[model samples]
Target: MLAWTALLVAIVVSFRPTVPVIWGDTPPFVESALLTLETGRPTVAGGRDPGYPALLAVTVAFGGDLSTVVRLQQAAWAVLMLALAATAQTATRNAAGLVPIILVALYPGLLLFRHVLTADLLFAVFLNLAAAGLLVANCAGRTARCCAVAAAVLCAAVAACLRSQGMLVPIATVLVGACVARPDTPARVAVIALSVAAALALLAAGSRFGASDSDQSSTVFLPKTLFCNHLNIVLASDAARREIVSAAGDRADATMARLAADFAAEPGRWPVLGFFGDACLFDAALDRDVADDTGNAVGAASAYRSIFLAAVRDRPLAYAGKFVHQMAYGASVAWPPYGLEPAIPVSTDDVPLVSDIITRHGRAAEPIDLQGGPVRIGLLSDLPGISAYLFKALSTAFVIAVLFWAVTAVWRRRPEFSARAGIVVVMWAASIVTAAGAHTLDVWRYLVPAVPMVSLMLSLCAVELAACLRRD
Candidate 1:
């Protein structure tokens, strides 16, 4: 009930018009939603996934404003996220498990994005729920297991539709389920194999059939073209084309067109095309520059594409070097400095405050401008820097601790701890590795879904630490 109250208040606060909210990828979503409402088509500025827009359209259909619907959903998800963290604690019998929820509640980055309309918050919620449900199902017997598997798969499918990263959960779930299922039991093995194959087939079909009108036909035809197809849509957009045109004048479209045509002409150029795509689309500095440029939003898009294309065409080595730099930077930090803002649109006057918070706190900076006065308070400032640093360091230590705990749990033939913790570790490791390998690693939003595993592991570590201290 307390959690529900907190979530309700947060949702109300998020709806306050005077709060100067920051929107990361939300403007495009709004555009898409409105477009879908108007024309019965999914058309966004950035050619984003249709999940959020579809959600908004349904809300609007029911006579709710976008802001009201979005804020309510976000708040509900945030509360649910906390509840999941608490449940994970109960499962592990760790009193300190609640600490992760508290930490997440105070996390400015998560708080900021929680109210936005991007897929990250929703993805995180569904992923965590799926994880928790799986844990519960595993702990219970066959009847509960069936329900749990269904819930897990449903949540994962929802997450996947919101963001491509969400597919990882289902994929990992299937893989782990298959590997761990008893081979001697032909029925179980066949069930697992059939389920996994069906899931994969559905994923592939969705990717192929669920494409929007704005999606580039060329890239969609190619296998292993996920990143490239996304890039092509981004590049083919009016904003991108306009930016190149403005930057290089007449040569802009021609140059970009030529580049696209060249790549299309030579299938061998796919690797080079991917390299350029990563540099232009994934670069943290580029994203930061786009965010910092407080001019017209379209102009910002144009400038970003212009800069990216120039970097790719003229200085390929420098572009690749920047990608490497961003990857290294992503691995070292607790959170990246980009993609912290809400996905909904914010006015020009609020850019500076948003920028300052994002830069200082990485993606965890959430500054709520109250209706009453000019007083600004950092929500997470209660923990001193040293203490926060120690907490984060301890979180990392917890990952290692959980590995040991999980190993011991397995050795003792406790499948509950072993399976749950093992799954968390696999997802965590996969998310980190995939993010690290990507061309742009600076956006912490991309890493949000994986944070739950980190939080869970950290909480486990904290419990273990407290236990050791008590014994000592």
Candidate 2:
């Protein structure tokens, strides 16, 4: 009862006095949602997954405001946190059980994200839910095990559908499940494999036949090609560039040569492309960029992949060096300075305080003013330096916790501990790898999914540390 009360209070405090913040990407999702509602078909375009827009469309259909949508997401997040708390309770035999829930309640990052307009919050919730399910399936009895496995597989599929990065989580979960299942329990292993396979089959079928759009060609290759171009033009070695140029068919080689020359003259564009996250180099002034044109996009993506592979084959040393550097930069402790905007949209301007977002890209200036309500916290905008310092501190603590868990889990040979911790470690590595490969290492938002895992692991490590000291 007390735990529930604390969680309720945290939700109220964190959300009181609605602050509606909107991002540049916010409009595309709104447009997609509104379009889907009008057309009565799921729509995905401009490099976005259809799941999020479909969700927003449902909210719109039900006469729900943005605040309403946010509230629902918050509720779902609360339930997930509660489930994690229950898992912790079971893991520790009801001792130190509330630690995970309390940590989640007070986690500023999660709380702040609870109101955002992106699918990231949903992705994080599902990731944690999947993790909780894994815990239950591994540690519970027969009836509970069957139900937990079903729930875990379902959560994994939903998470994957929400974001491209989430696609591998279900597979990872099944593999981890197999490893952790008792030697005598072949049934559990079979259940895990079947669940994952079924989910993947469903997702694939939906993508192939669910939408009515004739132009429903896959957009998966867009990110791959962009990552390759960013890497080849900016990070790859002279030998690698030559290899790429050699492999780039007649049409692309000339552009590649020009990009190589420009890179030699001005290497600063590398960071600009990395941090700002625009595929400026892929199109360049003289080259074509990937786009919605199905055939052209596919061809361009194929060419880019070929060149990247060629570079990797010819200059493995250089590719390795760049990979390490980019990953480190992406996962760095120093928070890039930016104001954390509230989740409220710009239409509500009557609130006591508000943040104005102006978009002027060679057109009439359009401004969105989001209400920040009566009380405003400027922790992200007003005190960026302090925020960065605090983030760095928290990040350092997370690293320590992960290291402790990794060392202890291995030394103890506990499959349960190893499976749970290993899943998180794998996801964390995947996030870094994706960011590094896509040249988004400088962006902080890419690492948000890893935050909850960090908190969960940290709490478990603390509990273990306390137990050890008591024994001593």
Best candidate per TM-score, number?
2
lDDT of 1: 0.51
1-472: candidate 1 lDDT, tens digit per residue: 5544553454344332323343656555555566566666544335466666667667766876545655666566556665666566566675556656555554545555554546677767766666666566555556445555556655666666666545566766655543443334555455555655665555554432353544322122121122232354335455544545555453454556544653354344334234344233332233223332443334444455454454355545544554565444433443322232223334445445444533442333334443343222124433345435644564556546665766667587545555666666665554545444333344456665666666666665566557668889
User: Which residue runs of candidate 2 sit more than 4 Å off their true CA positions?
Assistant: 1-5, 17-20, 34-42, 63-67, 93-101, 181-194, 205-225, 232-295, 325-390, 413-419, 430-432
Tell me the whole-model lDDT of each prediction, alpha carbons only. Answer: 0.51, 0.56
lDDT of 2 by residue, 123-208 (tens): 78887777777677767786567557667777777777667666667776666555544425666556666776777765664232
Clashes of 2: 6
Residue 196 displacement in candidate 2 (angstroms) = 2.4
Off by over 4 Å in 1: 1-24, 38-45, 177-209, 215-279, 282-378, 381-391, 402-416, 464-472
Predict model 2's lDDT versus the native. 0.56
What's the TM for model 2?
A: 0.76
Residue 443 in candidate 1, Cα distance off native in Å: 1.9
